[model samples]
Target: MNPTATLVLNNGKSIVIELLPEAAPNTVNSFIFAALNGVYNQHAIERIVSGNWIDMSYSAFHNEKAKYLIPYESQLHPEIEPLPSIAGCVCMGGYDELGLSGCEFFFTLRDCPEHRGVYPVFGRVIEGIDELYRLEKVKTKPITDFPYKNVEINEPIQPEIIRKVEVDLKGFKYDRPIKLPSQVLPKCWAMEYR
Candidate 1:
């Protein structure tokens, strides 16, 4: 039986995601842990970058578990899972930093070739890609609720809520969280804009 998670939205919409355990065991396990533990309930879809991806905020319940970071498990380990960051694929947000609130994640609205090796692609939306589109098109603007005078982050005017996250393993083995070096400093690089 395949590993799957059903995200029941408040609007009565449900999105099902097919997880890849063999390819991203730790990432999948982390997701399962949070979903089954009620971490995703009432969580908001924080941002939807036009024609790019829809980013969701991490549930408050994930604070402690977020300390454990899921390594970038993708094509780099083709023997396990080599799926790319294409449309409908779910990817863990952030880079290089381990324990830095690994709660934010995004769903690709269109093919994301640039994110190929940057994030961990753990699963894909098997059903309700259309529902994701509806969420992606929600009206948004600079988040006035938070203080970010320098950097601008667009947030939905009416947040899309994930009422619940239900996981169905169907007899799949659950792996422990992937433990990695947590105190690694984020690398900084200067990029020249054309």
Candidate 2:
């Protein structure tokens, strides 16, 4: 049986994601580890782009610079086809050089061709899509201070929170991913710009 994860949001809603191990085995395992270990707990949903997607775990990674360091599982093997970025698709977020965020993930709001291969898709939201849509309606504002190069990060004024994460791994083996020393991002550099 395939493993699954349910993200319980503070808004009393849950987003169930069906992890595709065949597509991204390590990504799935690492995500499952983070979810089960409270790495994703009590964090605010920080970034949102209307008609694009919602983001989390970026700011959290910066705040606490160390966590499970996993590779881009979808790209690990040529045979493992990465999922396309479609509505409700979940993916890891970060850059190629600096490396992807250990636990940072996002859900696409629509089919994003520009996002193909940019973010390795590992799973898709199987439930609570409506909840994601509802959360999208929250008021947001872009950071006027930071000079973000790429995608505009319209942060939620009253950020939503991931209250808890529950996973049913179905006994999947999740060996602890390698832990790396804290990285100091270059001046004027952040994951959002990548």
Candidate 3:
């Protein structure tokens, strides 16, 4: 049976995600491991573009802020039929050159055609999408003083938090994902985003 992860927010609201192991084996593995290990505890909801996505598992906002790299599953796994970035779908986040962030994830707010062939859709919301919608409507501001065109800061002004994530393995042994050769992010990220 597919595992389901319930993320309880600081406000007591929860978001339940149905993990698709077959669609994204390693991505799902990484998520289950991270959740069970308390990686998402007190994690910040870093970015939010109203009507776009909720950047939930960004390393930039994680407690460790560690850039744990993993192979981009969508590019490597061609056997599985690719899924669309429809509303409530969850996806891994990363650049093509470096590979996908082992734990970076975002929730699609609507049908995102542009995200196709880029991020792998790994999970779907089974319940409490309204909890995410509440965060979506939050007022956000830029992370930096410089107004760079590429840098559209959607940092929540009131600081949204993920209190905890509990997952039901349901007899599935979700091992840790095979980490990439490197764990650190590229130099470019250090240059600007840090």
Candidate 4:
């Protein structure tokens, strides 16, 4: 089954995501489970780094604390091409010394070509990128005296509230010749030469 759907938030904003189950099965499953179980409901975007992107720390931290560590499922097939971290691109958060990403995730507002091979990108935002851009442009403050220091410290600046994360995998269909959003197609296509 093709993993593709639109995630509608409470603020009337939405994000279309194209999941890569073949590339990152564990990560996809974990994300699906979280979405289906209301784990991402009402979660806020705790961190927002300028030019980098925003981080949904609360959701990730909550998942990690409540759920077991999701195994690292980086791209094993060379055929799966890596894509640029562009605006609306959703990526799994990376572990500090290890390659796996905990629950922390980032939504790219700019084209981050440098992060191609380093991070595991499981999805892309096809809709509501404008809203994400708007959130990325919001003003932020260094959270020094918040109740949750980890949330504050990890996310010194706040971006926008997620409101909720809705998963829709119904009627999603894609052939193997499909190309993912951003510049992932060429990267994956180049794999044929190697």
Best by lDDT: 3
List the global CA lDDT of all models: 0.68, 0.73, 0.79, 0.58
Candidate 2 regions with alpha-carbon error over 4 angstroms: 61-69, 178-194
Reference-based lDDT, residue 139, model 2: 94
Question: Between 3 and 4, whose TM-score is larger?
Answer: 3
**Sort order, TM-score high to low:** 3, 2, 1, 4
Per-residue lDDT tens digits of candidate 3, residues 130-159? 988898888898666423346455789998
The TM-scores of all predictions, comma-separated, are 0.79, 0.85, 0.89, 0.68
RMSD of each: 6.0, 3.4, 2.6, 11.3
Model 1 TM-score is 0.79
As a whole number from 0 to 100, the lDDT of residue 17 in candidate 3 is: 96
Give model 3's TM-score versus the native structure.
Answer: 0.89
Which has the better lDDT: candidate 1, or candidate 2? 2
Q: What is the lDDT of residue 168 in candidate 3?
A: 94
Total colliding residue pairs, candidate 1:
0
Candidate 2, residues 1-194, lDDT tens digits: the string is 88889989887889999988787766676677677667788888878887888887455445343343455554456676667788989988765655555677899999987777667788998999998798788899887554546658778898688888898878767665543445654333354553
State the displacement of the C-alpha of residue 183, model 4, in Å, after optimal TM-score superposition. Answer: 36
| Model 1 pairs in collision | none
